[model samples]
Structure formats: structure tokens, C-alpha cells
Target: MELERAVGTYLRHVALERGLSEHTVAAYRRDLDVYVEWLRARGIVDAEAVTPELVADFGAERASAEPPPAASSLARMQSSVRGLHRFLVREGRAETDPSGRLRPPKTPRRLPKALTIAQVDDLLDAAGPAPGSEDASAAQPASVRDRALLELLYATGARVSEIVQLDVDDVAQGDLLRVRGKGDKERVVPVGSYARAALDAYLTRVRPALAAKGRATPRLFLGVRGAPLSRQSTWLIIQAAAEGAGLTAHVSPHTLRHSFATHLLQGGADVRVVQELLGHASVATTQIYTHVSVDALRDVYATSHPRAR
Candidate 1:
């Protein structure tokens, strides 16, 4: 009862005082709950009685898990235990923090996957509006909307959420686009002539029809009924496009993002400039393209080298 009471207080402290997000607090609670249940299963009732052996066993069980838990997840679990024990010590409920000495297992990082330039082109071409032959009574307005979505994604490499939130006025110029990023920070990225032409087509022939209402709405992408385009709907558009293009890989709007950064990097764009275009908060985040480049080189080497197999 005492340990349970302490756990509740600790949880409140993490939630109210630490100001961690609800998702994070809920996650910590879940991990700690699992740990406590595992302890109870072993008939270890007292917090002080929880030994290094128990912790080690838990770590080993988690590490040796099949379809193994990721190292990042294991690290989070370890962090939860450390926090719980530290709370117990602080409240004078325990004499030692058993989890203090525990270490999480290290795991290898998976390299990022990138599509070829030709594959990217195929994907983009596939992303355009559905054919008139497919649906004889087809809506040309929606077709324009779909084409604009594809063009904007490839043009700015903006996140789907950002793209869907765009205003028709935002894409007026073919030369530049203002992008709102994380924390509502905004930046201007240049758009190519191809994207501009697509946007012009949509604006001229498509947008006004979808948006029959005279009210001035700021949203860029519009639904058939003229509301802002949703993230879920954007996902469906990308999937349909990939299928149309006969792409075997699972692709998303972000695949275009990866392709955008990759193609730019291959074309000798500076890492910092790519960082700005992607609106990555850190240059380190942009350096991921370098990894993509290395992976491309590896694929070439594997194909060309005599003993690469």
C-alpha cells in the first residue's frame, strides 16, 4: 500500500511538476506498471527487496525478446525504472535505487531507404489526376486538385499536413512558397516552373469550382465541398498514385520528401540549403541525406564488385 501510494505521488509529480506531455506521462506509467506487475508476479512485494538480480533478469528478458523490442524502447524502459527508484529514494521509501546500475542493450541503426531518380519521376507522374477513361462522368475539378497536390508535394517537399493547410494564394507565384513549419515557424522555398504550371492550372480551372462559397478561406488545398484537405485524404491520394504508377514499394507523401532531398543532394545542392528547404531545425537532421548518398554508393558497389556478395 505504501509503495502504491508512493507510485501515485511520483506519477503526479511527473505529470504536474515535470510538465511532460500527457503522451509521455502515459507511456512512463505504462512501463512502470508493467515493471511492478512483473515484480508482483515474482512475489517480490517490498520495493527495497527488489534486487539487482531482478533488474538484470528483466533487462535480459527484454533484450532477448523475439521480434525484439527496439533499443530505443529498452532505453525508455530503463529510464522509467530509474525514475521510479529515484522517486522511492527521495520519499525515504527505499534506501537504494536498484535500477541505477542497470544498462540497456545497444542496437544497430537501420539505414534510410531512398528511391532512384527514375523511380521518383515515375511516382510523380503516377500521382496526377485520374484518367477520363477510368470514369466517364469524372470530375475535372477534383482532377485539378489531385494534380496540384502532387505538384506541391514534389515542389516544396512540405509535409502533408503543411500542404493540406496551404491557401490558394500561397502558391500564386511559381518562384516561391511560404511554408509554415514546426512551432509555426515559416520559411520561403523556391518552386520550379513545372510546379508553378501545375499550380496555375489548378488555381485557374479547379480551385474556384471546389470552393463555390464566396467566404474567403485561407486553406490552400480544398476538398470537393471546399473545406481544407485532410491529412488522411492526402495519404489516400499518394497511395492511389503509387498504385497507378506500378510502384511495388510502400510509398507515402514523405517518400517524395525523401526523394526531393536525395535528388537535390545528388545534384550537388548544399547540405545546409537542403536543411532549409526541408525546414529541419538542425543541420544534423539534414545530414541524413548524406547517409542516403552512402547507401546509393553501397548499392552500386554491391552490383559492380566481384566479391561484394
Candidate 2:
């Protein structure tokens, strides 16, 4: 089979059948483009012409390129190539997977940065007036909505993409939120009181006003123009709150997620339970929070132990 045709088939399979997000599919496409071009340069346009040696050379060439790529980027690129060849072989379009022996470089394990509880409090406060305050009633529709957005982010430990994708009906179940996560997987997460109150305020008090400004939509969160809240807009909402709270550290939506998981683990929530709440397909992904908790314990021991240090 023509290598280009096989690549096209694999991309479509991943996007349509595997249900990968557009962003993820686009990354795979980019890496495959590079791989295809390199193969064409070597006068190899058929899938059967590919060899393990050629694939290994390609990996070495990418690894040794001037101004080297980050380990994660290199790994992802290699995975993209490997996935393509494997798919071709599995589909019987190729006799064997030439990229089988190609291995991604090991990436450094970086711990997620989580905010202290007080800092989260400050950030949430900066999002809007307190839920019961006189100012809460007077707060702008956007302010009420921003507060609800931040509160929900920490409450659910969901990805920003999942939060922005929520619809009005998705939150209708009292004290429970139906979150659609990666690959369209749905999970029910319990909503805390603070987030529920903020959501109620947004839904009853603010959302109707924002909804009136544009064409009818079922989206739970809306912009000043009443369009569905976008992921970029959601990020800006977090950034503005971080600035308002005088938080020096870089903050993003994932920071709230990390804090949610770390705090839960510190509070003695089981890692498997956290995994379920987080919609993590594997508990191994949730175990990283245990490391963050251990580090916190070490900090306390170093400070409180009188004979230490």
C-alpha cells in the first residue's frame, strides 16, 4: 500500500473510530507529516519498503537535531510514527511494523504544582463577591459566572475542556454533575456546597440574563454575548482571578485540578476513589498525588522536628 494512503487511513480511524480530540489528532498528523516526508526523501513511498533501520535512523535524526526537542515532544512524535506503522500492520496493509523497535526517550517525571488551601480561598474570593454578600446580588452577570466557573473547576477536578463542554442539563441532577471527559466518557462527580451555591447563583440569577442576549442555547456557561463559554475564555477567567488574588505563581485551570486531587489525597481520600472522580482511566495516573502529599509531610517534619537540621 502507498505510505501516504495508509497514513490517511490511520488518521481517519483515530479521529472517527477512536474518537480522539481534534487537537490530539492534529498533533499526530503533524508528526506523521514529518515522517512521511523523510520516507519520501529516501525514495520509499510504499509501506512495504519501510525498514527498521530507516525508522531507527529517523528517530536518531530527530533526537540529535540542533536545539533538541523536549523529551515529551520527542516521545509523542515517536509514538505517532509507531502508532501509524502498527496500525498499518494490524490492518494487513503492511507485512510487519518497521517502527516496532523504535523507543521514545524517557521523559522526566515532573510533579504537578498545587496551590495551598489559603491561596485557593484567596483566588476564589477574587473571582467574585461572596455568594451571600450584598455585593453578590449586585455583582455583574459575568462576575457571578466567573465565580461559578472557578468553584466548579475545583469542585469537580475536571479538565477545562470537559467543563466548557458542559450543558445546562448536564448539571440538573442536584449535588451531582455529569461530566463528559476525554473520548466522550461520562462520569458523575459530587458537587460541593460552595460550588453548588455559586452554580445556583449563576443559574437562577445570572445565566438567564446572559442567555437573553443571544440566540437560544443550552450551554451552562455563556459569554457576555451569551455564546457558549470557550476553553480560551475559561482560561482567561482563571488568569484574571489569579492576578486579582496577587498570586505570584503561574496559574492555570489545571492548577485547580491538581489542588483538588492533592488536597483530596492529603485529606485521606483513597487514590482509587480520586481516580474515579478524576475520570482517570488508570489509577497509576492518580498515584502521582501521593507523591505530592509525601512531599508536604516531609516539609512538616523538617520544620517541626527540633533536633533535625
Q: List RMSD in Å for every model shown.
A: 6.6, 2.2
Q: lDDT score, residue 24, model 2?
A: 89
Candidate 2 wrongly placed segments (more than 4 Å): 299-309
**In model 1, where do residues sit more than 4 Å from their true spots?**
1-107, 129-139, 213-216, 295-309
TM-score computed on alpha carbons, candidate 1: 0.65
As a whole number from 0 to 100, the lDDT of residue 204 in candidate 1 is 69
TM-score of each: 0.65, 0.93
Could you give candidate 1's per-residue lDDT for residues 1-309 as a string of tens digits?
Answer: 345565678889887776654567888888888888888889876788888889889877877889988898988988888898888888787888888779876656655566787776776666664333244235466666777688778878898867877776676665999887664668899988777866776776777777785355778787877777888999998888789888899888888888789888877889999999999989998897787787667878999999999
What is the alpha-carbon lDDT for the whole of candidate 2? 0.93
Candidate 2: tens digits of C-alpha lDDT, residues 147-252? 9999999999999989988999999999999998778788999999999999999999989988999999999999999899998999999999999999999999
| Clash pairs for candidate 1 | 166-220, 167-220
